[model samples]
Target chain A: MHKFANPTFFMKIANGIFPWATGISILCFAVGLPLALIISPPDYQQGDTVRIMYVHVPAAWMGLMVYGVMAASSAVFLIWRHTIAHLVARASAPIGAVFTALCLVTGMLWGEPMWGTWWVWDARLTSMLILFFLYLGYIALGDSFEDQERGDKAAALLALVGSVNLPIVHFSVEWWNTLHQPAIFGLKGFSVNAAMLQPLLLMVAAFQFYYIAVLVIRLRAELLSAKIRTARFNLAAAE
Target chain B: MTRKRRRLYFVGLGLLGLFSATALMLTAVEDNIVFFFSPTELKARTVAPEQRMRVGGLVEEGSVNKSGGTVRFTVTDTVESLTIQYNGILPDLFREGQGIVAEGRMGRDGVFLANDVLAKHDETYMPPEVADALKKSGNWHPEGATAQAAEAKPATTSN
Candidate 1:
């Protein structure tokens, strides 16, 4: 772990992973999207609106997964003082936030015809909303302090706090007598048919690859920026 | 291993503490996001009558019918119509020719049975999907009395 902690060594590994991850993401998206958007049959009940699920479900999954990643990275950063982990957590915020926003918008679109309103005070929806806000908070706190280290620590703290919301978001639909639909994917017997399930799982795989791709690129950029900062500081000391 | 590492360890512990607390708070409040829908989209896309939805549109003028506890009306974006049925008493803003949103399931009989209704009491409002559907239908007229008077009402409103 300590050997890999060297930023130069990390960058060597990251460079190799970046292209492979990007290629995989593109390939997954190309295959998964059509299967989701066209090849997959509409819901026996929802009709065409079920297409929104392809976008909405994966985004919801990304949102939760990214937060989980952020919290885990935050733990590593705080405990190990790993700069790469901090960069990874920082890099992930905006992408995760975007996915959460997409989830909310697509959800609103899906709910209108089926639920009768554009918005609802349901368990699932509310927890997701909070997740969105948490992402926003992480971004804000990460940049809030004058000392960059302080800012990073603050954001790490925020990410850890926000991680707890994820399980609640997943289970809220079940615990409360809300209008939101119950979980389609669970450890108990699966509710979704094989046709819809296959594409959904594919999309999930695609999104995971996409997140990894983005994180590597962003982390590299962050490392480069830090290097530039150090170079400038040394030049000033020499002068 | 070193003092700096020890310092980082404490910071990690602090983050874990903060994370657990916020997670609890968010879980406690996890019941507040609402969904919105327009009347026309509900008509075109909703295949199952029993599937739940949130239906939004202007309550057509003179279309609201009340018989005892039940109220029946046609929600319109002027291009498409969806019938709504609500059994409970409605809010004061639930008026004919006003923008309202209803949440419930579509009955197999092409009627929307609302469990809850929300009215946009203010004037500066139209459900966002109304504009989207109208754009698709090539009927871009803004809804309200002035616009209704300007263009010929569509085929369904006369019913």
Candidate 2:
């Protein structure tokens, strides 16, 4: 774990995993898309509109999952002063934001037809919206300062603070009388039937792999920019 | 303590404090955080008739009355039930014995005059054939199934 703090070592491992991630992600999507959209049975109640769950649920899971990654990495960066960890958090913000936005949009699309309203100020929905804003805030704050260290620390602190929303988002349906349904999969057992669960699980796997593939590319870019900045600073000192 | 150790403690304590604060705040605003109230909850408290609120419950079986543009239904949580009157298009999922949430003010009369009606779905998802079988077998429950009922059907499985 300490050795992984080295950016070069980290990048080497990331690069090795990148190809596998990309290949698996592509394969999952290739199979999962057809399974989710066409082959999977339409819901007994929702009909074709139930197809939206394939994308919406996975994206929602990714949104929360990515934020958990970001927050954990931020903690690692702060505690261990690992540049790679900080970079991982930085690389994840945009991707997490995109996933959150996708979740929100797909939710609205699903909601409009099924719930009779495009938006509601329910606890689950509101907490998720706040998660999206937290991602955006992390990005904006990280780039706000002239001193990169100060910006990183500030943004990392924000990530930690914002993490309080995660549990609230997950349990909001049960904790409150929200319009959102309770979780289909939880500690008790799966409420969803096997047929729907297959496609849902496949899509979730596809999204997870896709995130890894994208994160590897973004992490490389972050590493390169950090290197260029250091090089420029060294040149200025020499001059 | 080492500098790194100190930083670790700082972060750990910060998160602990933040979580505690959040829990307290949420507890303080518990009533406001609930999106809607069940029929039993609504009945348990005194609510102003003019104050707009959202009430959610299952639509009672055989209680739906549709007349032209106006629709009337009883929303029940098995413990208590409230009459809801709405004038608008209902969602595709709206049906008798299905859960629904209506937003509006309580009228001078006993009826709740709702401006918006949203259908709420349970977490259960199965194909039409399985649902038909369950219905035929007298094992169908709208909210969720009993463990015994679920175990009886080989076709029914969950992750």
Candidate 3:
């Protein structure tokens, strides 16, 4: 892990993996979309509206999973003082925010048809909204400080503080009487039928690979900017 | 200790304090955070007449009746049930023996006066064919059985 602190080495590995990530993500989407949209049976209750879960659930999962990655990388940055770790956290924010936004939008679409309300202040829904805000807050706070290091530290702390919401978001349905339903996949077993689960898993994998491909691109840009900043500082000192 | 080690400890302790504080606050506000109350909870706790709240449970089988613009139904948590009267459009998913939540106030006449009605579906999802097979085999039970076990039992037993 410490060896990855070297930017050149890190980029080498990232470049190697980027093509594979993009290819697999596209392949998964090629298969998963049809499976989710056309082949998978309409729900006994929800019919075609159930198809929305293919996108909504995976987006929600990505939102949470990306936040987990962000928080973990933030921890690594703070503890190890690794610039690459900070870059990883910074690169993750916008992508996670988009995924969260997708989750919310798709949820509203499904909710209007099924639940009769576009939104509700239920514990699960409210906590997820907070997650979205946390991502925005992390991004805003990171840019607020003029001193880049200070900004990074502050944002890292915020990321750690906000992690308390993750468990609350997950268990909110179980802990409270929410309009949202409980998790179909639980410790006991999947309550969903195999036919639906297959497509859902495929979409989840597709999203995971897509996140990785995008993260590598973002990280490369971040590295270039850092190099430029350092070069400018060196030129100023020589003058 | 080295400076890096000290920073690590400082960060670790700060996080610990933050988590404990959050945990305490969440516990303190547990009641306020709950989205709705079941019929059993409503009955156990005294609520002021006409106080706004949400009640959730399964729509009792054979209990929905529509009269003009008003729709009346019974919501049962399998332990206790409440009569709800709503004067609005129900969601597409609203049906007898399905989960629903009604937001309104308790009336003076013992019926709940709901201004909004939202259908709450369970977690279970399957193809119509699988659902039919489950029904035919007499093994189909709705998810969250605690709330719908009574209504679902008779159908299963008859089969």
Compute the lDDT of residue A36 as modeled in candidate 2.
Answer: 87
Model 2, B22-87: lDDT tens per residue?
A: 999999999999999998999888989799999999999999999999999999999999999999
- All candidates in order of TM-score, best leading: 2, 3, 1
Regions more than 4 Å wrong, model 3: B145-159
Judged by lDDT against the true structure, how good is candidate 1? 0.73
> Which stretches of candidate 2 lie above 4 Å from their native place?
B146-152, B156-159
Q: Every model's Cα RMSD, please?
A: 14.4, 1.6, 3.6
> DockQ, per-model, please?
0.07, 0.67, 0.51
Best by the lDDT measure: 2
Residue-level lDDT tens digits of model 2 in A27-82: 98899889888888887888888889999999999999999999999999899899
Q: Which candidate number maximizes DockQ?
A: 2
Q: Fraction of the real A/B interface contacts present in each candidate? A: 0.10, 0.83, 0.79
Write the residue-wise lDDT of candidate 3 on A1-239 in tens digits.
67989889999999999999999999999999999999999988998999999999999999999999999888878887888988999999999999999999999999999999999999989999999999999999999999988999999989988888899899998888899999877765666677788899999999999999999999999999999999999999999
| DockQ of candidate 3 (2 decimals) | 0.51
How big is the positional error of residue B127 in model 3, measured in Å on the Cα after superposition?
A: 1.0
Q: Which candidate achieves the best TM-score against the true structure?
A: 2
RMSD of 3: 3.6
